[model samples]
Target: MIIKTVKSLSQALLLVALTLVLHSCSNPDEGSAIETVVYPSDVIPFMDQWKILLGDGTHTDEVEDYEAPNFFYVANDGEADWVVYKTPNAGVTSRTSSNTRTELGQIEHWTPETGGKLTGTLKVKHVSTSGDARAAASYSVVVGQIHSNEGNENEPLKIFYKKFPGHSKGSVFWNYEINTEGENAKRWDYSTAVWGHDMSVVGSSPKTYPEEPEDGIELGEEFSYEINVYNGIMYLTFMSAEHDTVKFTKNLLQSEFTSKAAIPKQILTLYVSLGRDGIERKNAYAGEIQYFKQGAYNQTNGKDPEDNMVWSTGSAIYDGDIAKQYANGSYTEVWFKEATVGPGTAPN
Candidate 1:
């Protein structure tokens, strides 16, 4: 009888130890005394291939085994580990951008002819809960991007995820900004839906929200995407466990929207009010140096909605205080479990 009692006690002790381990992993920022702390490189091992920009405008190229307390770190949500990218709605941003981010920029650049590929498996943990609903950038974040290093420095692609307050599901969409033929003042982006509504679907007023999408992703749901630019053609693949796989293709060496009359009706609706109707260059993004970016690029900001209805979010920011913003739900957080960066692969 005594032997059996000891065996039962041993099993209980093992379970208790596992619980303690999980608690430590889920809350790494609680303290720095954790000996089992894991860095982002420990999970993905691709940190050496990229540099990082934190929400507070901290840049670093030495992420071999690094972790920043509030901006970048590791988290485990019971099942698996993830590299967390978090940023407040308002903070120090790049010179060209108003929003903030804690993101990784690929060190290597490639032309459309040379080509490259980037893949990621991730989930959205949080998005700003307060914003003017009529604004397109409200309650949203950009997860991946293909940024140009030449011309007007316009983005060729941006993958986004957005959710409205009080809604259980959000949308996953992508935008393609036209390579303007002349002055970039008229540049505009055309959005396409991947899992739910596109950027054009917004609330009618500051407080009102559109009807929730029936086919949408929830916060903390896992999804994957593959971007392959091969021989001047860009191929995209998106997959989720509960949703059907989706794919798209675009030519970077050729222009798809070079003519004024060729514009889609959606673009007319989204940008006609802003007077942005520029056409793309004939060669599109050909011969331009481009790089990849991945992480939580916070879209919401404290800019007044009356100024620019599209990009302005008019969300609460706690005066650019990151700690207060995090405590009050004015931030974005993304977690990635898997990712890769290398040369492009021919499609099977």
Candidate 2:
């Protein structure tokens, strides 16, 4: 009888343990369901081809299975996954730029003749809301670029998206910085509009905001761009499902703004006060080493706009506190669902 009782006791204990395990499995608060976390590399597989610089000045080349909190990371918005690039209006930036960025720089360098291409499907999530409305660079962020890695490290192309506070729609534009013939200090970017007004559109006073673009893109609207430099010529295509598609062709081997007279009217209004009327060299970014960059290059800063109204943005930084700036709308965020880096293909 004692032996039989001990066996029964052991079986009862086993049954009790099984019941507890089943109950825990059904309880979400006490469940052991492992959630699979996603990384930027999982969403976009081109992390190996590029190195990244985060908003707080973190740089890394090995981005495989890597994710940085509140800066470079992956996000899911119910329907799709996105690689998010976020930065405050002010942060520890690289030596070359006063502005901050959480952007990817292409590892492979190429000349215009050698040719390369980059494509990104993204949407601008947020832009700094506190800035002088009259300042041209205020409330703006650069999303893509063809950056010159050599010769003063000037940028050949910078695609921008800007919106004033209280505006429902924003402008999309691209700027070409003159490969200044003599002085890099005199370099200026020539702006061209794709959907709405170019970078030159601004209010008359510091606090006044301009009218919203009628044919503009909203903050979360999707857009895509293709930058193809083939045989010393750069071909650009901007596309969106709700907006008209636009294409532009520019010659990298030749200068379009070689003379002062070639300067566009937008520049006259935007940079004439700063005396940035320098012209490009005859061979514009032809032999210069170049690379592609994509992400949120924050244009807003805490500088006084009265110093350089065209380029400076008087945004609130909360004494360089990134958390405060992010909470107060003094930040920029961009999300990319897709991106590609490869050799330039022949134009169709």
Q: TM-score for model 1? A: 0.90
Model 1 agreement with the true structure over 27-49: per-residue lDDT tens digits: 88886765877899999999999
lDDT of 2: 0.93
lDDT of 1: 0.94
Off by over 4 Å in 2: 1-31
- After superposing candidate 1 on the true structure, give the runs of residues whose Cα lies further than 4 Å from its correct spot: 1-34
- Among all candidates shown, the one with the greatest lDDT: 1
Alpha-carbon RMSD, each predicted model: 8.6, 4.0
Prediction 2 TM-score vs. true: 0.92
